[model samples]
Target: MKRIYKISVAIVTLLAGCSKSGLLDKDTKDSIDAQKFFNTATDLQVYTNGFYEMLPTYTLYTDEDSKSDNLIPLSVDARVKGARIVPPTNASTKWVWDDLRSINFFLENYQKCTDDAAKLKYGGIARFFRAYFYYEKVKTYGDVPFYNKVLSANDPDLYKGRDSRKLVMDSVLADINYAVANIPKEVKLNEITKYTALLLKARICLFEGTFRKYHSLGDHEKFLTEAAAAANELIASNAYKLFTTGGAATAYRELFARNDQDATETILARDYNTTYGRQSVGYLMTAPTAGVYGIPKDMIDSYLMKDGTRFTDQPGYQTKGFYDEMQNRDPRLTQTTAGPDFSVYKETTREPVNLSITTSGYRVIKGLPSRDQWGSLNSYNDIVIYRFAEALLVLAEAKAELGTLTQTDLDNSINKLRARAGMPNLNLAAANASPDPYLEYWYPNVDQGLNKGVILEIRRERRIELFNEGIRWDDLMRWKEGKKLEKPMVGMYFPGLGAFDFNNDGKTDVFLRTDNTTPAPAGTTSIINVNQKRLTNSTSGNFNPMYSTPCTFDEKKDYYYPVPTEDITLNPNLAQSPNW
Candidate 1:
């Protein structure tokens, strides 16, 4: 049975009493007899199973990517549109600590178990989750109040001020270190293992390291060194590798489309099986009436040509149509988005780009499963949490930022991904000798002396390889490139605006016009009103779905979200974020 099913209703009822208002307010201890519950390995395992709820579900995979430059959704997010406001209470703030309270509650009483092995195992899992919880808090609102023990409502520490980033991160590091040292070195796809803890360590350290370096916070080298070391250990373990059995054409897409998580590459995943419950990933990615998220041109432009050359280097690339642009690019591009030749199955029927489904013409097909699964709560694909490919990227980026990267590092890290995509190897010397001006324009703040160019390439690789895995926003935040959100997001291009062939099958795939009365041209599969759909230029140019939405990024105030006014009012020492 799946670990998710093992969580009992009794445990759920116990954890449900945690209050969301004050940090660590509700004490569930009075409700349950901890002495009886914390007595055996099975008991500890059952209690710890609740911690898995903290992991992300399929919603994050489909929704969070829209907040980044990778996809344009039906509606612009308030954060992306510069419309976010400080909340009156903790309602809108991500400041809830109920999960932490439960984790800490378990930690405080788990020692009653007498089983040393189970105690250490479950204890490590609790600490790992605590580290994961704090990492998210730190990423959203820096300098959060760190708590290891479950606090009573009237505890003095409940009203204390926020801890320093350095102090809190150091504590998080300690927790993760404990988790790594104690967790069993076993391969469990649905359960957290030692390697999963290591991945979390590498992820958080890399975020902190780059955030410090870009935001001018001090002590970045310590975190970068730790990040590189963690990633190195994971890679040296040889426990996982990139999923390449599907080869170039299907390897990347198959990673997400399959129902089962490929254990060879996926270290940890959120289990979604038919017996448990299904998700809406297939419906959200393919339904014509509801699927509004679309891959943007900026992300589409990031894919390198098949021969390892930059796609932007080609002449007249900007004005190229959908069919033309799809030609000779990375195989992942066609696998991820709707091209002229895209089909859901091996049958002869082709899936044309549906304008109604995607705000941008570039419909995303990365996570969509078979046609039979495109119904509400019908898909059973597991959502990946940690994979070996990310470990490799983390190691390479950490080394590059630390100015310790070499050609060997590229061959092991970025080159492996490139090879999976059927692209040539990334030559460190060539990259450093002449950086892609296109990537440099996106990340002008990357100034690592001779390693600057290679760093830019690594960033590009990270973006392309991990496009919709819910990490793009954090990447932008840590790099201090929030302003990129303000740029106009566009899709496929059109020279004039009339009937156009999306698949290059000698038949009109779509018709674009400003007038609503005129009938669509014959053989057109879809008709789009440019006035409603929008274009960068009045009559022609790239499809600009969000042209009317005003997007602004205030570098001073936007990086970290403001704390709730109510929380600050309750405890005056709990200061609001800067420039809120």
Candidate 2:
């Protein structure tokens, strides 16, 4: 499939985009003076916005929904059961290159500023933005170019290369350190800050060090230990506090809806609205009738109960239909997902709300605006880029990787997340259940009982806390658990519903997933297996050999998205990730 976007950034003549400096028009060397642009507040504001302009590329890394759904399969929540991505071509990779290049470009000239505060503030923001880009790159591709200054076309060793992932990590960590030391402690709701930089450092270090150690990267434990140390320091600082509310919906639904409320969890957010740019996660997830997006029925199954039972696992779970399935579970589920009974809207005197229950029976609420947000003035919500929940989860992952986490460790990390959602704290010792079974499922390769089930607990918190924030893909990757299912996509079928009987035939709905399959009555293209006697993919669309049902229980390699085609071309030196 053709990649869908290109950078609108202007390429100044006489300059070349540098590997380290990124995609600056490069006129800084012998052409336009960098000082001219950095001299005024107006210039500084406009210049600062250039970094924000590239934010769209970061989220656009997904591909077509079907017909070789590549990045999107991983980008969106399509690969849980067994979805696959199309091949990566040149166009798709350029975006990553351009995104990184934009930040490098900004930082290259940002230093030329004569004003001290502007230099620190603007430079801090630039470094933080650059670090953010590399963090994304590192998460997806392990190593990358670490350019900090403008490089000229004639510079020798133009071919002399990408630093090791470790080296890149050093660069990322250093920039974050610099940012924390320079920017203001209290940047306005609309701006980046010193605390933002430090918080970002906590996130990246935690993610990088934790993920590597979890996957057994070189010096794995060393990285994780350092990452955990970094996270704990942030926790100890108490510069930010958890967003807490007493109302039933105040726990999480409040933070999810109020984008800019500084709950201490949010590290940085991509601002969205009708005017400044908007988030259509709702439009993309809810059906057309909902004026937003809709979550498929398969995804809704991933939610676990307060007692940690899957809806399907609970006795008599299927009878109550979705309302009961959704009830008494995490309250965040209702806030994140819309059920048939949901009737929320702006207010009276407003046009009729055009929401539907969705063909799959779910709606997108998290990151969506109230009906009144449309038109005129922009919706002032911050698209959460980082939240404290991640810090806790990262720490949990780091501790688990170290295999040194304790009951108390799990309590503070994952259990606290569960408590936030009103679920019982996970207890490994209380019920006399050894964490061994969970660990065997998780770190089967690790020696006898070192993992101790902390990984699963970490995942549980993430699943409940980070839903609909575009985090699942990254999640499946770092955990290395996105592709366990053979058939990733499948249709949804109730026990006996939606079965089509052609010619008014009575017996036409049976299907199976093995060779020598049999087709049922007319119009029913299916067969029955000795194991499953009920309906199959006849009328319900559940028999795709390729697609995996959302939560059919899985883990796999197609989890990491293909580095966009455009990114590859911009940095041919960089290679496609394995299994992409």
Candidate 3:
């Protein structure tokens, strides 16, 4: 357990605030120093509060999904390209452990507090964050060294090798379990509670369980049971439920933009204040006008029809144009994208489809606020980190994977989410009878023989419900479906180079051409954009912006990120990840 004291001291002091004016004024009765800072309950709280910044904010949360199949970037990342050669000196390499030391320092020092209740409560907080830190590290680089306590500069344990995944995850489970049992039960806006710990435990356990099950690591059932039990505990608490106080179509969007004090669905959120300029670029980046990040046609095709039928099952589904295809689909589709009669600020209705705003025809509308509330600094809607819907998905998937699922369980978990969206309940018997063709194609790993149909449907529900919330990359990695990257990234469909009406509003929206010399149809109102290198094929008869070359993913190496080369050099005992 080697620790870098320079980084550790700066982080601990800034977070713990030992030298800050009034941080120690409450306990002037005792001497204030680095080692003596943990003498009071207030000290324990301030130290633990420092860890909240470790959680992902709104921008960071949504940006993560760009790496997955759900959202396509203006340009593909180097990590997602065909030949991902991550060097040892790559600046983006996530092969460090400063967060671990911050957490371990608290665990080692919180016990020094004389108050029993304060010690237990704050100790639980420390353990919970420790679990979070390690889970992220393991998810990024598998089998990292585990350290439970802060170490000195010359500690020999710092030279130790990587620990097994099982050993590290078991310790994570222990930490989360302690936090779940000892943490307070009060409902909070953004504070950790027993419910928070339970939801995280469910999330982490499900990830490990599915990873092991898919990668053939064994003992998957044990982790699945843990996931199920943790989710069940949170569900039984009766403190949270789906946000359904408004129309089903608008309910999902309102959940993200609402600033109400009572948010029933959200378990934990990263709050922001517009006046303080603590906002995210949710509107500017994801809006149809920005064009930086856009949702793909593959994700749009995944949504079920309003009647809960597969859209791909319809004849000529692939050939259907954008406006007609969006009709009678899931309500979430309309809410998520700029559909017909699209409006900002809920005032005027107009169809605005700017090709420059989105690479795919469909732009992101998930976190966009009203026109008056829309700005880089004024978008203060709280970003939800965890909510009850994830708990429902986790519970249902865990049970299905464990082969212990039933109609009653589906009714309790998946059915609740469906009802919120005004979609029909999923029938276990019908699902097991025949899995959807689209799902079977996308999630090829589910083809393995073990409750295939229900498992696939559960996965579908998870994707549809939690698409832009930034969990897709982890979901794909854990399920061993990274090969999805190889699929062609296509956008709005077109017959060929022609002026087409995307919104079907009796007006031309986009004018396609093989070259700038190609004239637009005489006097069309469509926006004339020249096609040079913008699309994969200027004359390929379809709209694919990123079709320069087909993408490829190496399953053997892409699953786990490479351990930084510099880190391996520093510690000769450390082994590089496979295929690095």
Candidate 4:
């Protein structure tokens, strides 16, 4: 609940432009305005069409996982490592009101249509976006001002202070509930529907519920119950399902790379086409040698064995080699990262010997494109935003945290995901008897109770299922587990930098020596630029690829961002978040 930044324009003076510069007004006769825009359902549709553009796509390649343990970038971010500073103004801040303004504009004008059904339908769409807009705001800054009306620059409400998070979330709940009731029941891959609204509602509720509970803010059950109810509604409807078009190993991989999104699982996705101006750089950004992206050794170790047993439980598990470590693990492990016999972009003929691309030796294969679609900065594959898999995880976690989860709940929610991954069902009693040490260390604040084991499992499932999808940072933040950032950002272990065959292709594919003048040894395909890449004790044996640098996480000051000084100066009613 930080007052992060001030709006550039003071609300009272926003509409003071003179007509000489056409600043006060342009010709509304030809241009779309509030009165002219919502006259017909077609007009309403066209106006709402802009809202879909606001939906996230992989094109915005700010992979937040880079800020967490899920993946490591070329360099550790100073901000994530307790080096952030408050900016002078809102200019450099991510906190923006334009998206809210757009949604509020539509909501204020969508009722011009006389047809009751059309009005309700379009209004549902507007409300859904409003809810989404506020959800992002509340999550990012907490206790943001809520507005249903499209405020003019001169509107008094523009200068109002921040509202309580509870009030804003209640408003969001109302909007989403209306959307679920009135949005069309018919499902579409790229468009929002009643089910999409339900999914968003569930996600929002689970986040707020968990956040309040972990932060010790009371009345958390209200949001937990809402989250559970929304997820249960979707489950009962049977309108959506986890995409299992192929076998377990390949199904998960295919879900991200398919030309079209799998309608069974994906409720709404941001679409792209070669001809369309909108294209995604996700593939290129994550491609080999594109950026120094790699998963941490800790994350790699979290994947369970094929039979749903913890890999860490295996004898000598920590000492296993790269290829050996990947064997017979969760099918998703092989799907998400390159494993033995892995090929480039699903092309069996193309061998994955590009060791230069992966810092951890665990190359990322999720969402990469085939040879045909592998242009430098082009990929038309849709980025899924809302999906049934996430809803299932939300249901399981929320129920577990509420302490009301039953074996039946596990059978319904977590079991389905495990089944899709070709793993066994989780046994509550067994998991408690031997909680995974890796997860317990990551979430050390959690109390050992009846729900502890199930909660840990749910967290693992959420991370593995949603890895690289931009959910980790928010999950950590809401759980008040930011201290995990201070943990070492370690990658695949190596005895020493030397020439070795990475893919076991019977050819030495990597020459990892530190000497720049040393030409790659015979048949080497990758070179480690020690000066450029991170490595723990680069000069010594037994090094980590990702933990070469030092970083820290300030438990108190780093949790919520601070409000800008200018904003607080402008409005004394505004207060900074705790400790900042």
Candidate 5:
């Protein structure tokens, strides 16, 4: 895997030319001219390396889940709060296309290199990134304008309206398919490869398929079929598996904590090295004033028991205190959240869950670094972009939605992940016979008849396994469950105001009181004023993070973001999304 570093000034200048410029300025000469630069395979490699910048960095671990119910940050997200508005100008818009222009520029000029193999390799990579770029755009705003070639400032197409979703997605499909067929088969943890292309194809197809199905758009089956096929092909390749060397007790958490990417599971990742620069994931997730991200009680309730049972089915489950609730649950719950034995970097003693860091009582432990890499801009763990477990889930989900899923499919896909977690394999028949009510309640739109039970189970699996990985918001959107965001966000249960031991280690972890005038009990690590925190029952229920602030999800307009007002004004043909 190549360690991504700063690119040369020549490549930087070439990329800068793709920015907003007039017709005459578009052709202006730079330090290293584009015509002269595209002469060798090494040049192609150097130029394409810039595309990695398009991938996510530490934010993937810090607060990417804030938009979904899986996490609650100190400050609610504007989108979650239904506070999004149409920006006044393109400058304030996230709809910029300079990256697309750069990729298109490379595609147009890569033929200058006489080496056919090098051209095909780099060309495939360029198309993969272009597909990636468009996938995000399509997710954000449906029916965006699709540009294949670099447009000159005077080009008439610049004033045209948005293209049809079919046209743009079809173009994206072709680019990803070409990438899968032409990219090298070799596995590179930090570079795009055949498997990475395959993963992207599956992801794009699954999203489009589910989104179309749930949104009542036509032609949903084709995308689902393609999604299953792409995932199946990747699984059949035998190139990757779950990273289980650490065993069920530690493998899952260690996978994200390691500084290096695990070749067994990670298909592609953003490589970060201490030598280049430090990453801020540790500080962002663990610092009191930095991230302030917490796992919600609703999400915590979704994790199945160790013996493969729903935690919500147990008697008195709602009011279970922190220590009792964390007992004998899915190992992932302990791995992902700070539990009885969880300690911060370099600390031998188990740290109490600080409400100041996480507004909710649950602190996220996934992607947290060791003692040596704990401070601001000091961690360097490689953030995963694609992994084998997701591909498996995609395959299982696509098949289930298509009504072609079978027990064998479960054995091949979902069960693989369950095995790595030391949990029992999911039985298709049993799951269908008795669907989990909690899952069905959360995803009411999953009406696949007999397949509905298994589908809901798969969604639950996806939610638990992929929590805090930055995929929940898209999952909710694709499933047409945006209203879940409006549901109350709460944390650990409290019978009433009193000092208590959260980890069951005989030490008072927190004192819940009504006012500052009341002194906390001795040895209490933290004091949370229940009046300020706002419990659901006024004094005894779960911690309510949004008791004072109400959140809304507009079914009509919240699904798609509105275009910038100035862009719509500049091109009168371009129309804004409905109800913006």
Candidate 6:
């Protein structure tokens, strides 16, 4: 196998103890040579991998930060203090305040040193990484300082912070442009390919440009047109195609499972294996005993049938509930969630643990350590940040918004995904799903010509295609429609393995619940006993917690997340998002 290699530049150290006195107490910065440090071939190896690994950790917004509360995951430590989601303090804001620090470092210094193809390669890597990082910031924080140069801590100009959303976006676009121009179109055999940078550009541009255009922030139509054009260029390249049939369960599932051998759709992935990055997010979310995390009910419902109908809306879906009900439902769902008797699983270790979910009711089998190696706790799987499938979706969305989704759009956009699944094209009119109808509800001025609804459908495609690969929070934020949609978190809670019974569905054999005891235990009276379910305080109104809870789209206030208080203090000129 031809392995993708990186240029490894060894870390050079400055002589130690320069602060003591005399020769040893000399200034360190003066003694160290900045130019030679970055030029080392060994430095690029570590730098490149570090760049790839950092993408997932970039947390302007993450699922945990957005879930339950507008802070990091509700930690056990905080709950003990009787306070929830420790408010944004200065320390909490370091990452937020300094997200651009590293990117700026590389950008300002990359070109000062070497033309040694090896060092220049790292330059290209840094450019793409910086742009990619800024792209994420734009998506979350709106306007940010598009710093292309490193700033000093003592620089008096630090107070000149904040720029309008448009400025940041345009600058972001420019960086991607530079990246595309400077980076290769294809990398023969390397960790980060030349084609990968181009693909990243296409995706970032289309997303930002379409979002601006869809929301009518500024020259949206112009950007959308340009984005569509870029997307089309990628489509015509034909270097990638849909991963169809024999590809279904095992191959399709393995694509994200991080087995590099099966990464057909993956354009750029954060590879973790033999090396301890992470494997099977399953254990983190599954019923613990099952050795993985269970999938959330809402996540499970996101997949569409192979025929494009919702699993619930399909024939026998209600009756069979879990029988791959709609033959048309996207195969990705099965690959993501565990079945009533989930079939596609591999054993990696020999320990004997409960693969079945006795308490939580459902468990995730995808991306878990292979079944047999029960004791092999760690599993290595790569997370795909950019994939060709996403590129296709972006193309379809931009084209649909620009005008009617042309025949080519069908072939390139939705059809490619369907083709991979051996399904037919969606007759938009026949499907009775009008793309423009949401326009009526979204904006009153039809002349605005903003068919954000089309973009929302594209957003929907994104949700289904890339379910819970740690993107639900940002995906919800990016869409004008999701921001507008009123789907509240009104889904049922499965407070798995706790005394807190969300709702007792015990009466119906179809569902399982712990039920309320006749006498009741201390601190457990909050639930009402009925059937086998206990209705808890989490559900108070019409929406049954025993079944589903509430998630409403509070348009007036919920759009932008609040800026961490610490960030506001450091950058006084920066303004908070509206209504935050």
Q: Where is model 5 more than 4 Å wrong at Cα?
A: 9-16, 19-32, 345-348
State the displacement of the C-alpha of residue 423, model 2, in Å, after optimal TM-score superposition. 2.2
TM-score of model 4 vs. true structure: 0.90
- Residues 1-580 of candidate 2 have per-residue lDDT tens digits of 1111122334322222434323332334554456566565445545665566544422321112221211112123444444445445534343235455456556666566567787888788778777887887777566555666554455443324456788888788888878878887773444567766655776677667655754667666655776677666566666655566744344676676653556456655565544445444434433343232335444455566656655555665433444356666666677666533344433324122222222222445565556545333335555665566776776676776677777787777777777777777766554224443432443343333444454554555566576665566555455554333322332233443333322122444333333344444454443334232212443233322233234443333453445555445655675665656
Give the worst 10-residue stretch by lDDT in candidate 1. 1-10
Winner by TM-score: 1
TM-score for candidate 6, please give it: 0.73
Model 6 lDDT at residue 323: 31
Cα-based lDDT at residue 445, candidate 3: 87
Global lDDT scores for all candidate models: 0.86, 0.52, 0.76, 0.74, 0.85, 0.48
Itemize residue pairs with steric clashes in candidate 1. 340-503
Candidate 1 regions off by >4 Å? 1-6, 9-16, 20-22, 345-348
Q: RMSD in angstroms, all models?
A: 1.5, 8.5, 5.6, 5.5, 2.0, 7.8
Q: Per-residue lDDT for 1-580 in model 3, tens only?
A: 1110112334464433322111111221222365767889988877777777678876654577777787777777655566666566635666656556667767767778899998888899889998998899899889988888655546777767889999999999999999998998977867888899999999999999999999899999999999999999999999998888677878887777665425498888877664434464555554444436768787888889999899989998877877789899888887777776566535566745665666766777776666655555667666788899999999999999888999999999999998888899999988988888788888898735557888888998898899789899899899998888887777766656667776675766677765566666554544534364244445534457676656788887888888766667767888988878
Q: Candidate 6 regions off by >4 Å?
A: 1-32, 40-49, 57-87, 90-99, 112-120, 187-190, 261-263, 275-280, 289-328, 347-366, 372-377, 428-457, 482-557
TM-score of each: 0.97, 0.72, 0.91, 0.90, 0.96, 0.73
Give the better candidate number (3 or 6) by TM-score. 3
Off by over 4 Å in 4: 1-33, 60-62, 278-289, 517-521, 529-534, 539-549
Tens-place lDDT per residue, model 1, 42-92, is 988888888888888887776888887888888878888888899988875
Candidate 4 weakest ten by summed lDDT: 1-10
Model 4 agreement with the true structure over 1-580: per-residue lDDT tens digits: 1110122232212211222211112122332446645788876666666666557667433366776778776666665667777755666564555556655656766677877888888899889988988888787778777778655546676567889999999999999999999998877877778999999999999999999998888889999999999999988889998899788979998998776775788887776666553354454545665655778777888999888888988887766767678878999998888777777565677463665666666767787667666666577776778889988888888888899988889889989999998999988777767777889999987647888988999999999999888888889888988888878766665556677665666776666677787777676766776655545666433235545466677777776676676666765776776677
5 versus 6: better TM-score goes to: 5
For candidate 2, the per-residue lDDT at 347 reads 33
Instruction: Give one clash count per candidate, in the order shown.
Output: 1, 46, 5, 1, 0, 60
